[model samples]
Target: MRSVFHGWWVVAAAFAVTFVGFGAAYTFSALFAPLQLEFAASRASVSAVFSIAGFLYFALGVVSGPLSDRWGARRLIVGGMIVLAAGLALAAAARSLTQVYVAYGLGVGLGVGLAYAPALGAVQRWFVARRGLASGLAVSGIGVGTLVLPPLAAALAQSVGWRGAYLVLAVLALVVGGGMALLVESDPARRGLTPDGAPPPASAPPPRGVALGEAVRTRRFAGLYAGCLVCGFGVFTPFAHLVPYALDHGIAPTRAALLLALIGAGSTAGRFLLGGLADRLGRLPALLSMFVGMAAAMGLWAAASDFAALAAFALAYGVFYGGWVALLPAVVADYFGGRAVSSIIGVLYTSVAFGTLVGPIAAGRAYDAAGSYLVPIVLAALANLAAAAIVAVTARAPTSSR
Candidate 1:
């Protein structure tokens, strides 16, 4: 048997870290009900925890991406694992809403922020030729993690309580995530091999990087950023609120949590399947398809008064939303080149942060005032539709819009 390439090991590390990091974060949806009961907090207010954590998660990428280039992914990931475990432990022990905010918002946010970019960036550096497949395969863990974690979390909440579940997650993060960190190589140079195990090209120097300043000024970047902002709003708000939303519709808690699992299952497929389509059809088209799908899913969610409709929403949203996540690295790599793919992705992801930060808070407010998710859900679908239009127009034409 041929020895597994070290690059695949790096992919393995990326997968494990993502599974733990994202799985823990996604549990916030299931955590919402318990937190509301304990804290007597309103939906919008309790959701601030997720909003703040997500904000810090995306915002800190600016620092972590550059640091990953200077230091190494392994160091960042190891450090992040420590921080993540501590944050989960801290959040678990909190007595008040403020403590929850500090622990999950700042602590968890900072830890996840530090790790995510470096992990994905390192994988991108390792697989130049198979960039899409490697990234999709690696990020598939996010979907799998999303799929498996929520139901287990719901079960734990019902049995041991949410705090115990959190402590268990803290242990899992430290053990599984930290051990995997050892296997990651921040750059392929450390393995004495070029990216994708390719031989060094003759005579030509490596391509120069696109400066962040130059990249932001481009029409393409502007459009992509705008689209991400909208997509983030549409996708993440539902992620944070889906379980509770289903519960509001009179669904059983476990079955409501299964809605999130369906998203994860569909996403796992999307990351791999649509990721390959991005290689063939172009990243913009793949993104367009998924964005449109997410918009329609949201519309279905708005009308969903029954289990079947909600389940359909979960499955559709999971596939498209997962496709969006998987395609991002390839899109950034293709547009910006690998010179600073992580940094570019990190910057582009600020739009995602913008979406995540605003979406849940806004949705919460809508829920609080109107006692229904109809407004925001419809708005989310509109945002996604607009995102699709933005990508189609800007990518096809050189100008900002058609």
Candidate 2:
């Protein structure tokens, strides 16, 4: 009888790590209103808390990715979970919004930054043929976390208050996130197997691909980076403000929180279904579709006035967003190969870091100035469309030599 492949175990572990890290990070939406009420801060100032955290988590990947390449993913992931827990605990004790920015922003941001790229890099090394499916499955944790955590945070906030809610989440990060981090391994070669679990040929060479410096110099890389950076300008707006948007339309708090859940649900399905579909449909074209789909969904959001329309927008947006997230690492792996993948991915994500930092805060400021989200939503849609054009042009370029 054949033993089950260990690569799948890595996928499961990656799933849990992402679930805890992103779930905790995303719970900011649930905490948003309370923090505003507690701090007497402006919308832009409050949103900056998440923006700072988002920027750190994504931007820090540049350092963490190279470190993970040198130190192994497990160590980085475990350390990250600890840092995340500590950040949350500190945020629980914060007396002012500035403290929250330091504690939660740095803590959650640094924590996720350390773990995310390494986990993704580890998963990329474990498979070749099913890279898209595996990548999709691994990142679907973000969707699931988004689906489950915000509502849980909202409920806990109602019962125990936001500080107590942060405390509980901190404990969860230490126990669950740290525990799973143990199972991640950077390379299948250590276990005498090749990618996709085939026994290594005795003469087989180590995984081969472009180094980070060389990879970064390619036109393909430039297009991918530019596209992601442009999209970043609008990509994270909903994650930070969707609940507030729903509430502004007179939706109940619980129901409003569930809107994020709807995105998660749609995202989960997209990662699972569209990921497999991309393997058959061609990954680059599928990636292009995601940008187009997100642009269309953002249009729906701009026009939505009621619960039904908002829910539709959430589900639609979630599907493409989920697919976009799932496909990126796989596409990176496909274009560049496994060597220096973590480092390359980390660098690529800096685009997202800048966008994450600016997008939510800009949306908040726009809302504050105009008393509505219309301008930002429309801009976000346009940004996605621009991203689609970039991706389309890049797809026509030759793939990088493996």
Candidate 3:
């Protein structure tokens, strides 16, 4: 009888953790209108909550990354769950927008940052050959969370109001998240297994690669950093504004929520399909394809007006964006090796953080200032095209030897 590979267990755990964490973090968009109405805040002001939380998420991941390599992800993830729950609990009970900022923005954002990179990095350690597939499966939880949670959140909000919906998420974070933590091990070596469930031949280099500090000195790192920054920025604009953009165009609130679900739906498919593609086509080719698709999709996004148009945008955005997320950590492994996967990926993620930081807030401010979403949407389309071009150029650059 063959025992199941423990690496799969790590993937399963990562899936659960990302589902709850990203689902909760992204719930802000679903909750956005309600929060805005309740607080009597402007769109930019309301968006500040998610923006602040997103910044903290990226910044904290920088620290959590190296720590994941040393300490394992179990403790860090468990701690993240506790923080996430507390943030939700605090946000649920809050009487003022300021309190919501501290609870949801600072608390939840910080917790998610701590959990995300570490969880993904741990998976990188588990599989070498199937790296793309494993990451895609684990991160599909993020897309599913986005897809399922918003509609569910809308339903919950209808039944119990937004507060109850948050309470539900908080409880889920505590229980499901805690159980998942027990299954996480930073390295399969702790269980005496090599990557991809077999020993490498003596001639193969060890999966562990150069230290992050040294990896940063290479041309490859700079290209990856700059490209990811643009990718992150272009990707986040819609997540922050899509719901409101829909509502502003006279879509019902319930229908507005569906746009996010559509994106999530696209993301789920993209994660698995593109992940498989990366493995088969080579990471660079797969990445190039997704970036090109996203560039075209963002053009679709800018022109979206009707439900049909918006739905098209969601599906297109989801597929390309989700694939890009799944491919990245594996790409890092292709470059830097597995030993410091989290640390290296963490730094790259800060570019993602930079995207989340400026994209959402800037889009929000642009909408507020211009009294229209058209500017931001068009800008996002251009940014995506730029990112695709940059990544293509980087693809041609020489690989790092470090």
Candidate 4:
């Protein structure tokens, strides 16, 4: 509880954790082929491993969020880092498919779930006036990590064995996540302020908190949740499948790798630019624009045949998608109230987990059936368009205390 003037430093720490932790998780796409060959597994079986990891990462967030609210961010994040490191290290030595699934799907999934909620929740507590910008800066670490890790992972897999890559990743996770945990704490109670930076009155009792059920029952809560679901589903397509799709399209592996890297770069820019903009345009408009822009980016990906077009699509899409992730949690807090923001946001985030589970599996299945990425990319574009439509139509109105 040191009195730091700039709470944004906390956000920067959160970003660093997310950049390494979640970034490594999303980079699994680059690991799929290596894993499949490593274990002599079929594509379907290999895909299931990552899908399970995605599901656990997302589904567990529902509980992790509430737990963070109850337990505080520091313990949860440190614990998650330990679990993530252990899981990755174990996976490096895994022999059976079941071992791999348990190491990755259970350990990594739970670790991410534990870490992600608290990271955002801590950042949410630290700022109010510039909530959008703060959240963007913190979450944009995922973008930075995504850009940096996947290609690095691909290279690691090529040079060192995949097992060695996992060992290196585990070490990276421990170093980054552990260091960031030192900077993370819970609410500003130690600093004598509510989330909005207002000093609590000397004699006034604390305000009543909202229950989870009551929060969910509100109209605004439902709207925000639906909007986030669409946000989750729409932006993930290009992210999850882009690397493989590029290689399939006869692009050089290095160029395909760069395309994914551009996405990470775009996401970092988007989180800052769009998030800062949200503080001005109002959060709802910012989110709505993200959905629309993401839909367009997905379409661009489906249509692009060359490196330039694909790179442009990644740049444009990554920016909006990154902003959407950063802003939505803050938006959840704004519309629903902050008392249960972590839990509410966690539940809302399940849609992304669901999308992550479905996107790669569905895309891979479609590719298997059709013998091409064309149909799957088109379908992903259509899904994004539909998500944009849903966001456009969802009602937004402020709700009073429940």
Models sorted by lDDT, best on top: 2, 3, 1, 4
- Per-residue lDDT tens digits for candidate 4, residues 176-227, read 8877877887777776666556666785454334667777776666666665
Deviation in Å, model 3, residue 101 alpha carbon: 1.0
**Regions of model 2 farther than 4 Å from truth:** 399-402
Output the worst ten-in-a-row residue range by lDDT, candidate 3: 199-208
Q: List the residue pairs that clash in candidate 4.
A: 19-141
Which of the two, 1 or 2, has more lDDT?
2
TM-score of each: 0.95, 0.98, 0.96, 0.92
Q: What is the lDDT of candidate 3?
A: 0.85
**Cα distance off (Å), candidate 2, residue 348:** 0.1
Q: What is the TM-score (0 to 1) of candidate 4? A: 0.92
Q: List ranges where model 3 is wrong by over 4 Å.
A: 199-207, 396-402
* Clashing residue pairs in candidate 2 (N, C-alpha, C atoms within 3 angstroms): none
Clashes of each: 0, 0, 0, 1
Give the alpha carbon lDDT tens digit for every residue of 323-362 in model 2: 9999999999988889999999999999999999999999
Once model 3 is optimally superposed onto the true structure by TM-score, how far is the C-alpha of residue 296 displaced, in angstroms? 1.5
lDDT of each: 0.83, 0.92, 0.85, 0.77
Give the residue spans of candidate 1 off by over 4 A: 202-204, 396-402
Instruction: State which candidate has the highest TM-score.
Output: 2
lDDT of 3 by residue, 1-402 (tens): 148888999999998998888878877888889999899998888888988888888878789998987888889999998999999989999999999999999888988888988999999998988999999999998899889888888889889999999899999888987689788998776677888889645464455688888877777777778877887765777777889988988999899999999988999999988897788889867876777778788889778888999999999989998888899888888888886889998888888788887888888888889888777777777776777677667665555544
Q: Which of 2 and 4 is the better model by TM-score?
A: 2
